[model samples]
Target: MHDIRFIREKPAFFDKALARRGLGSVALQLAELDQRRRAAQTAFQEMQAKRNEASRQIGEVKKQGGDAAAQLAEVAALKEALGTAEIQEKALGKEIDDLLMGIPNLPADDVPDGKDETANVELRRNGKPPVFSFAPLEHDAIGERLGLMDFGAAAKLSGARFVVLKGALARLERALAAFMLDLHTGENGYTEINPPFLVRDEALFGTGQLPKFGEDLFRANTGHWLIPTAEVPLTNLVQGEIVDEAQLPLRMTALTPCFRSEAGAAGRDTRGMIRQHQFSKVELVSIAHPDASAAEHERMTACAEMVLQRLGLPYRVMALCCGDMGFSAMKTYDIEVWLPGQNCYREISSCSNCGDFQARRMNARFRGAGDKGTRFVHTLNGSGLAVGRTLVAILENYQQSDGAVLVPEALRPYMGGLDRIVPHV
Candidate 1:
């Protein structure tokens, strides 16, 4: 959340940030809300004070054994006025909070100002795109031909945007998740966590997913929302707490199944496992002090890139344009892996430094050793990598001309040292 004080002090800067994001100036609307809410609070408090003083006058009148009828009636009217003021105060406060929640985080000054992915600046490209003398098939064509990916079965079980992996394919999917978790925790210094798949409304709010984008989530029969990513649980672990400064950087990682409704994303990536209603992923979350977030963002981005590096997959890093950035991120870096089948690079991981936007919603704070006050902890999250898409990339990129798929050297042990997958048929 942008500090209201900051917005108040620099309305033009705030509006300019919004314009770059393809949004109109909200400075007037937000400032109006702030003014109205504060006005209500001031009116409410004045009336409350008046009501208390009136009651005291009535008490003194009765104690003097004089006529108290006039004073009693005045007290009743004052009580009614105070009640109305309190109601208005509560409503205006709620409206102000909703307006604040709708505003996206301000982009970092260095982020390029542009609209959409076309304007996204590529920071670096690594590993050469694979070469194929013969026509290479997409992952869906390769997997379906190998008698492994059973989209037909998936359709029967759960309709669209889902897949069923059978035999070695299913085993390979599980192995990818385990391999990612081990690498992140056992070697990358991230503490492994087993987080809840179903979280409360506040957890989503803390992660800046609620109040907007509610349509993109799956609500359960009991009203609990399914997590869109492990980032929700892992990042919210320190919600509403004051931590010691010594633990300024808290790194946590989790491998969990994420569910998204994809409500607004109807026609994009409709084929295969590129986009899905359900998928497993390894997520990395960091809670860092303000002074450390900038450096930590680079470090976090590198961690995500490491996954693709180890798998020998070609990829590039793109700094997202303002309009293409996520709601809670001040700055973002997307790692797009090269897919030979698709003949393009697709985003496989996103690392972002949210600053204190989430911490404000979560009330998550930390205190320095000798500080008199606590400060919000800056939060960061990245996909160590999306396991499902990684599998698809592997199948498509490593496909042999003869319909066999070779496993990368790093994933060989995960796949039981089997060099290649053959058709089950």
Candidate 2:
């Protein structure tokens, strides 16, 4: 959420920022709403003060043995006026809040200006795409040939965009999650948390998922929405909390199943796990002081890159442009892993610096040791790696001519020292 004071103080600057995101000016409308709300609040306060004074006068008149009927009538009238004023004030305040909540975070100054992924700027690349002796097949074909990935069974159980991994493929997915969690929790300074997969509407709203992207989520009959990412639960750990400045940056990680309805994603990546309704992912979230969030964003991206590096997968980092960033992110870095099967790179993880956008929504703040005031904390979340996508990259990158998939050296230990997965035959 945006600070109304900022908009009031710098409406032009705010509008310009919105323009960069391909949005029209809302600062004017917001300021007008704010002004009306403030006026209503002042009127309510004035009427409340009058009512109190009138009640005091009524007491004084009664004590002096004078008729207090007029004073009592004035107090009653003031009380009714105050109620009306208060309602108006509250309504205007809600209008401003709803507008602010719908507005996407302003892009950072350094972010490139453009719309969509085509405008994203490539930052850097790690490792080289592998050269294959034979034409590489897509992950789905390879898995199906090995009799380990079954879309038919998944279709029977669930519907489209779902896959059932069996035997070694399933183990591979589990191993990827384990490896990511270990690297983030053991090596990186993130605490491992097993958060709930289903959350209430408030939780989703706190993370900027509800009220705007509700159609993208899966809501249970019990009214709980399935988490779109671990980012929701992990970041909200500090919701409505006021932590000491000493704990400026609180890092957390979780491996959980993410569910998406893909309501807006009609006919996109319909073939495989790329855009699945259910998938496992290792998510990273950080609650950092505003001053340190930029550095923390870089560190978080590096941590995600480390996963690909360790697994010997090729990938590149792309800095998302203004219009390409997520709803809650001021800036974003997407790590696109090279997929031999697709003959292109696909996003495997995205690390973003929210710059207090979500903190405001979550009401998460931090207070300095000697300061009486608290400021919203900056929140960042990234995929250490999407386990399903990582698995896809592995299957395509490490496939052998003999129809076997060599396990990445980093994941061998988790796979019970297994080096290769042969066709089930």
Candidate 3:
């Protein structure tokens, strides 16, 4: 949510930021609505005061045994006028709020200018992509050859964009999640949380997923939304809260099954686990002091990169362009891992700094020891790593000549010391 006061004060700056996102000028319209709302509020206050004064006059006149009929009628008229003005004020306020809520957060000045991923600027590359002696197979092909990844079965059970992993493959997915959680919580200073998989509408709104991108999500019959990512729940932990400045940054992590309808994502990545209706991800969320959010964003991105580093996955960090950033992010960094089979990198995690956009929506604030007022807390969320995609990277990168996969040394303990995943008998 944007501050209307800011828009009122700096309409040009706000519109310029929106233009970078390919959005039309809305600051003028929003300012006009705000003006009308304030006018209505002023009218309401004046009418209310008039009615109070008239009532007081009526009482005084009756005390003196004089006629109060005129004052009574005037008070009644003012009462009706105030009611209409109050309604108009509320309606105009709601209109302004709706418009503000729909607008994406203004991109940070440091963000690159672009319309899509094609314009994203790569920051740095990590390990080199593994060399293959023979032709490397895609993750799906390798999994099918091992008779472990069953797409047909998943289709029968839950339709397309789904997969059923069995035997060592399934265990590998579990191991990936466990390893990510342990790494983030034990070493990265993030408190591990097990949040509800289903959330209320307010929770989604707090995270900028609802009232705009509702079609991208799945809803339960009970009216609760299936979490699209752990970011929703983890970030909302500080919703409507005001914390002490001492807790300048509160970091949390969760591994949860994410559900997405892929509403606008038709015919893209339809072949494998790359785009799935359901997948497990270890998400990281932080509530940080506004002054420190930029540094926190870098720290969070490094935490995610650490996961890929330990797995020895070749990846690159890219600073997302303004147009490619998420709805609530002022700035974002996407980590894309190398996939030899696909012969290109794919995004495995995105770390973003929301810069109080979500905090204003969630009413989350922080106060210092000597402060007389509170300020919105900056919010950040990132995928420590997507477990399914990590598994995909492992499968394609570690494929042996005989169709087996070598588990990464970092995940050996979680995999029960299993070094290799061979075809199931």
- Model 1 gets an lDDT of 0.91
Q: List the residue pairs that clash in candidate 2.
A: none
Model 1: residues >4 Å from true position, as ranges? 54-74
Q: Which tens-of-lDDT digit does each residue in 1-425 have in candidate 3?
A: 99999999999999999999989999899999999999899988888888888989988999999999999888877777787888999999899988999999999999999999899999999999999889999999999999999999999999999999999999999999999999998999999999999999999999999799999999999999999999999989999999999987999999999999999899899999999999999999999999899999999999999999999999999999999999999999999999999999999999999999999999999999999999999999999999999999999999988999999999899989999988888
lDDT of 1 by residue, 241-270 (tens): 999999979999999999999998889999
Against the true structure, what is each candidate's TM-score? 0.95, 0.97, 0.97
- Provide the lowest-lDDT 10-residue window in model 3: 75-84
Which 10-residue window of candidate 1 scores lowest in summed lDDT? 1-10
CA lDDT, candidate 1, residue 293:
98
How large is the C-alpha RMSD of every model relative to the true structure? 2.0, 1.4, 1.6
Worst 10 residues of 2 by lDDT: 75-84
Show where candidate 2 strays beyond 4 Å.
59-67
Ranking by TM-score: 2, 3, 1
